[model samples]
Target: MAIPKVFITRRLPEKCIKPLQQVAEVKMWSEEYKPVPREVLLQEVQTSHGLLTMLSDRVDETLLAQAPQLKCVANLAVGYDNIDLEACRLHHVIPCNTPDVLTETTADLVFALLMASGRRLIEANDYLKQGKWQEWGPFLMAGADIHHKTIGIVGMGRIGTAVARRAQGFAMNVIYHNRRRNVEAESELGARFCGFESLLETADFVVNLIPYTETTKGLFNQNAFTKMKKTALFINAGRGATVDEDALYQALLEGEIAGAGLDVFSQEPIPKEHPLLTLEQVVALPHIGSASVETRKQMISLCCKNLMRTLAGEKPITPIETSR
Candidate 1:
C-alpha cells in the first residue's frame, strides 16, 4: 500500500514541520519567498492526502477536482479567501486555518503603522538621513496626534477588536461598523456601534479591518473618501481588495484625507512605481501584518496540527465550515 502524502506550499521551519512528517510523507516546495507554481501545486496534490497552503495559493474548483485523494487543506493564515470554501465542502475536503494566534501581533503592527504614518516617522527619518536637518525648528516634520481621537474600525472581528483594545491604552475613542453589532466590543472595549458613513465622517483615524468579499471589494471608493474628514488618517491592515487604490491615491494627492498607512496592497510585491509609493504621506510595508517570528511558527504549528488531525480521523483545531 502506498503511504499517504502531504504537500506543503512553502518551506517551513523544521521544528514546526517535524510533527507532520511523523504522520505522512511530506513534500515541501523549497523556496522561502516564492510560491509554488500552479502546475506544480496541482501535480503534487494529485497524490496528496493532506495539503498545507499559503494565502498566495489558490485552491479553487480546478485544483480540488484534480486532488482526488486530498482529504484536508490547512491554510497558514487567518483568512482563507484564496481557497474556495464552497468547493472544498463540495469535494468533502475539510478546510482549516490558523486564527486567533496572530491576532495580537497583527494588531500591534497596525497600530505601529498608524503611529508611524501619523507622526511622519519614516519620512522624517529619511529626511534626517539625507542631511536635510540643517537647524532645529519648531513643528518640524509635524503630524497628527492620536490621543483622545476617534478611531473608526471598519470591521469588529477578532483582530479589529484586538486593535480597539490597544486603542484604549492610547486613550482613543473607538467606534466601529460591522455587519452585526458586537456587544462585547461596545461594553467591554468602550466601542460604539455606528454606520459606515457615520464612522468615516467622525473618525480621526479610519481603519479598514474588514475581510474581502463581494460586498467589501472596492468598498473605499472616491465617494467614501470624500465622506471622511479632511484631517482623518486612513489605515488598512485588512485584505487589499477592500480599498480602491486609485481613489486612495487621489484622496492623498488632493488632500481629501490626511494620510495613509498600508500593509497589504492590491498586488502582492506591489510594484515600486505604484502611485501610492510616490506619496510622502503614505507609509507602506510589504504585507508584514503577521510577520513576527514567534507568531509565524505558532501559525505553522497550527496548520501542521490541523493537517495531522484530519489524517488521524480527528476534528481540526480551527476548522472552516462551508455548505455550498
Candidate 2:
C-alpha cells in the first residue's frame, strides 16, 4: 500500500517528525523558525493527506476548499483561533489541538511575567546596563509588593487553576471569574469565584488566561483597563485578540494601570512603529509561553500523533469535540 503524504507547516523537532515519518511520507519546510508564506502553504496543502500547522498559519475556507485529500489538521498549540472551524466542518476536515500538555508551562510563564512586571525587573535591568546605577538609594528601583496580595484570574480553566496553585505559594489570595463556576476547582485550589467586574475591582494584579472566542474577542478594552486599580499590574499569556491594542496603549499612556507584561500581541512581530513598543511600563515578549525545550517537544509529538491517528482511521488521543 502507498503511504499517505503529510506536510508540516514549519520545521519541527526531529523527534516529532520521526514518529510521523514512520507512518507517512513526511515533507517539512526546512526553515522551521520562520513562518511559511501563504502561497507556499496553499501549494503544499494541495497534495497533502494531513497537515500539521502552528498558530502562525491562517487555515481558512479558501485553503480548506483546495485540499480535497486533507483528512486532519493538527494544530501544535492549544488555541485554534487561527483556523476557521466552520470551514473545516464544511469540508469534512478534522481539526485538533494540543491542550493539556502546555497548561502548566503556560501557567509558569504567566506567573513569571506577573512577577517581572510587578517588580519592574526589566526596567531595573536596563538601568544597570546603561551604567546609571551609581549607588543603591533608599527608594531606588522601587516596585509593587507581590506577596500576600490578591490575584484575579480572568479565566479559571486548566491554566488558570495552575496559576492559582502557584499563587498560593506566595501566600497570595486567588480570585477568579469564569463563564461558570467550577465547584471542584474552588474546593481543590481554594479559588474564590467572583464576577468579572468584582475580579477587576479587587485584584492587586490581574492575569488574563482566557482563550480567544467570539465572545472574548476585544473583551479587554479601555473600560476594562479603567476598571483596574492604578497600582495593579496586568499580565496576558493568552490570545492577543482578547485585548484591544489601541485601548491598551491609551490606558498605559494615560496611567490607567501601573504596568503590563504581554506574551502575545494583536500582531505577531509587532511593528517598530506600534505605540505599545514605545511604552516604558510594558514588558513585551515574542510569545514564548510554551517555548521550553521539553514542553515544545511534547507538543510537537502530540500533534504528530493526532495527525497520524486521524489519518489512520483510529481515534485521536486528544480529539477536539465541536459540540462543546
Model 2 lowest lDDT segment of ten: 315-324
Residue pairs of candidate 2 with colliding backbone atoms: 11-32
Highest lDDT among the candidates is held by which one? Answer: 1
lDDT of 1 by residue, 144-217 (tens): 88988899999999999999999999999999999999999998998999999999999999999988999999
> In candidate 2, how many Å is residue 163 off?
0.3
Query: Which number leads on TM-score?
Result: 1
Off by over 4 Å in 2: none
lDDT of 2 by residue, 41-70 (tens): 999999999999989999899999889999
For each candidate, give its TM-score against the true structure: 0.99, 0.97
Tell me how candidate 1 scores on lDDT. 0.94
Given candidate 1, what's the lDDT at residue 215?
93
